[model samples]
Target: MIWQIELIILVLVVLFGFGALATKDLLSAAILFGAYSFLLCLLWAIMGAVDVAFTEASVGAGVSTVLIVSAVLRTTRRTDH
Candidate 1:
């Protein structure tokens, strides 16, 4: 495993984490979270933890993203005064 690649992925994870927290839109935040999960999966794969990577890819990035996006789409976005 290359340290440079690991460093890059780690940086991206941090950026995505911050982005998800800072985004105002729920959908965008969900997408960022998915990307974050995917990067973590990649890191795990590179580190030789294929099983954990697969689990994260499937459950974290895949199912969770779909569920969050669908939930966001079905809800009404309203600012009540």
Candidate 2:
């Protein structure tokens, strides 16, 4: 049962990772990246690496998302094809 749960989490991480990379909008991408990071943190925690997971949550998902969103705020989400 635990392995099945882990597998589902792993699949989510992969899907979110790809979603982040594939999105054309910067804001969407940034948010997806944050979600990806959060999922990664969850995966790490599930694997018994609580310390690393905490760091990823605080740094990867938290601080980095704020930074990226702020940077986006200063600019625009428009992309010129």
Candidate 3:
């Protein structure tokens, strides 16, 4: 069912968000954030917003993830007190 698919996507997004927050590695966190965005795109598509889903998949998951990963790569991966 559509609702079931939406629920699954929502769960995946939540899990990815938690993973991003809990991850120690910046690159891994960025990847998790990208996964979250991808799940959001799926949710949008299931809701019948194809245009919005396309934009979210491309911009949110693809471009934003690349930018975040590049930024992470430019900085130190570890934090110091």
Give the candidate order by descending TM-score: 2, 1, 3
Candidate 3 residues 1-81, lDDT tens each?
Answer: 467777878888899999998888888899999999998898888878999999999999999999998899899885545
The better candidate by TM-score, 1 or 3, is 1
TM-score of 3: 0.88
Give per-residue lDDT, candidate 2, residue 69: 91
TM-score of each: 0.88, 0.90, 0.88
Residue runs of model 3 more than 4 Å from their true location after superposition: none
How accurate locally, in lDDT, is each candidate?
Answer: 0.91, 0.91, 0.89
Provide the lDDT at 10 for model 2. Answer: 90
- TM-score of predicted structure 2: 0.90
lDDT tens string, model 1, 1-81?
889989999999999999988887888889999999999999999989999999999999999999989988887532233
Write down the RMSD of all candidates, one decimal each: 2.2, 1.3, 1.5
The collision pairs in model 3 are none
